[model samples]
Target: MNVVLFNPRAQKAHRRLPLSLLMLARVLDCEWALVDGNVEPGAEQRLDALCARPGTVLLVTVMPGPQLGVATPSCRRLKARYPGLTIVWGGYFATVYPEAAARDPGVDFVVLGQGERTLPELLDALRAGGDPTAVPGVAAWRDGGLVRGPTRASVRPADFPDPPYERLDMERYAARTFLGDRTYNHHASAGCPYFCNFCAVVNMFEGKWIPDPADHVVRIVRRLATEYRADAIEFHDNNFFAWEKRVVEVSRGITDLGVSWWGEARIDTMLGFSGATWEAMARSGLRMVFFGAESGDQDAIDGMEKGGLTVEDTRALNRLARRHGIRPEFSFVLANPGDPERDVERSLALVRDLKADNPDCEIILYMYTPVPLPGMYDEATKQGFALPKTIDDWLSPEWAGYDRRRNPRTPWITPGLVDSVYDFETVLHARYPTVSDLRMGPWQRRALRALSAARWRLGWMKAPYELRLLQKAWGYRRPEEMGF
Candidate 1:
């Protein structure tokens, strides 16, 4: 079968063929083409070109909010251009809102939950000229009616075919800063074990961590580095360090392979491990690690249900990472429910303290948005805040803006906090010039200020796509060069 897998972005045009699509292609043993939705300015043009070919099935993956807006128009255009062509929509957004996604005129089938097994089955059925409505995990529009099927059983990560790395545009992705020069993406584990209120990972995977065997993980990394010439590998697991023994084994295996890699770990996992384990990781080429330290305030931490991490715990972990020469990237949320001005101030102060204490470490501050997962949205509704009426409402273009705006029942700290945090970091850098400086400089600072101002004045609603582009253009600068 001729299959085209598409990754669609909402605002900015930045996209690469997702590693998932490559895996899907290998499973079907079909001719596959991966397209970035934003490569052209208009979705119609891109969709038309893809639909122009005969006997082609388009599998479009979409994330939440404006990205859905971006993908929906394209799907609609494809349906109009080639009425016989099959259109399948998958991803987190489709999983969460299968019924709504199925209702869209452009979407023929919505694959809820993991598409690894179900997608191939649906395609095979279509190839056999079988009824798509019989496919499990599929919500389909047929005969002027919608048919929703039972959710398919989850598939183990090991069950997935090794991703078809040969099919990817390796050079294009390698040019990106985050992916690094010789980057290969692999998943050692699937699903998240945690039940954080604001997290969708658990909901997406149903609170299960289907980890691949350590040997399997080792094999993939070895191939990626030795054969694919990957300079680095990224463990795409939601929580890499959830299992201590598995992580240790993986670390040892990576060391054995003599390759560099990066992944995300919860603060608890770091604190739980011995210093020697981290040292081994560092020796094995674990150059960087990301941690989601939502807040420094203990009350806020409790509210977020982030156990095993206190302000002090984070500090100690920072020290441990520094001792091992692993660059620790800390992610912080500026606002949460019931967060007052003081909480915001304390969070900022904590960021300043961390920067002061570990000048070499990287800290990222983000404004809080209530993700539309079960627990978080339930809390938001219980608190009497206006819940996002549709999936599109959750697409926050403002996230790419410099200045933040307030929403109903959201804490007062929401407005101006982005600018305030940027300013705070700027001042902190100026006050402590001796520290390893990672601040935005004059030109970049002015650019952010201008972007922020434009976003605030014009609003993200008017030009959602442009805001995404602006975000990528100005998102990352060298820490030493950028004031914050």
Candidate 2:
């Protein structure tokens, strides 16, 4: 049996090694081949060629929304071309919407939640000619309906195999760096502890915050630094500071390695970290930190169920991080459902204040995208928002909030209002793109700010992608530089 895994090509500066797929490969008992759709343009053709010499060929894919749109059609085409191929779907989208995913005849099985334990067992069953229905954390069609197996228990990082970095082409993957060099991405924890309504991380992990043992994290960091000569590390955890002790231990261990690192943490969570811990982390080479501030207004924050986090907390954290010599990146969502124009202004006000306080601070603005997970998706439909009806709709860049340039997922907000906010955001990015830009002459900065204001005042504009190439030709910059 040929076990193949794929990484869907994404349009980002960094190509993340499909860490989950590599880990699954570590525990599997059969010979496996890893395929990167990003590096291999003719991935489908390669799969087709493999099927010619195979007995039972299993093609497993883990994808998010945009990739799913591309993969679903590709899978359908492959199934039609070769009937013997076994197709499996996993990852955030499939775990949240198994029934919808399995409805596509091309997908023979849906691996729910975590795949480390369930995937190997499913493969074993297939190899032994036994019923795969007994395998937990799996969803498949039976009697013309979706049948989901028992939910598998979530595992901490210690339970999984060490990340199979050997499976990826390390030289081909590079993360865009803001302060330091691009580094290898790793996670010290699993699942976010927060219950923000817009979050899909918690839902996918079954609402558990699991961290790898401190020793396990230290060992991995040391190996990456000594063996791979990694100059930096990106902790891809949803919230790296979820456990204070774990943060202290991991930071202290990596301190001697002298590798600058980055990670995301909530403002509310960071408030609890002692000054000593923050100082320790700084000495450990924590150069950059990302915060999902979500919104500036307390009301908007409450609306998202992002418990008790306020604009004040964001302000304090920005100041504190700056004091510690750690560059802070704050992200905000504009025009969320149930939020009014005044709320949008409040978020803008917060951004202006933060920039004034710390000109070097990175501010990210996003349109509130409606993700179709259990809690948030239920709320969206209840509020009369239409969910994607077919696989193609799910794949369409216009429908998914993550990829859409013009569509606003928050139906409650008018299109004109959304456009206005985005226009203001364009101005914001134009003026304060990065920390280094702070060194620009005051006159040059003021001129760009005036231009941004003029652009917004020019009225409703098409989405960025619609005008990206023209803007690029105008010598402003490319859409990719804008973090598209």
Top lDDT model: 2
lDDT string, candidate 1, 403-472, tens digits: 1212323434454654565555434323323212223345654555554454343322233344344434
lDDT of 2 by residue, 58-113 (tens): 55564555577667777787777778788888887787667678888778898987
User: Which regions of candidate 2 fall more than 4 Å away from where they truly are?
Assistant: 174-176, 372-379, 397-406, 435-471, 474-484
List clash counts for every candidate, in order. Answer: 11, 1
The TM-score of predicted model 2 comes to: 0.88
TM-score of each: 0.80, 0.88
Give the 10-residue window scoring lowest on summed lDDT in candidate 1. Answer: 399-408
Q: Give lDDT per model, in order.
A: 0.67, 0.72
Q: Model 2: which residue pairs collide?
A: 69-395
The list of candidate 1 runs beyond 4 A from truth reads: 9-17, 37-47, 125-134, 140-147, 176-180, 256-258, 374-376, 387-419, 425-484
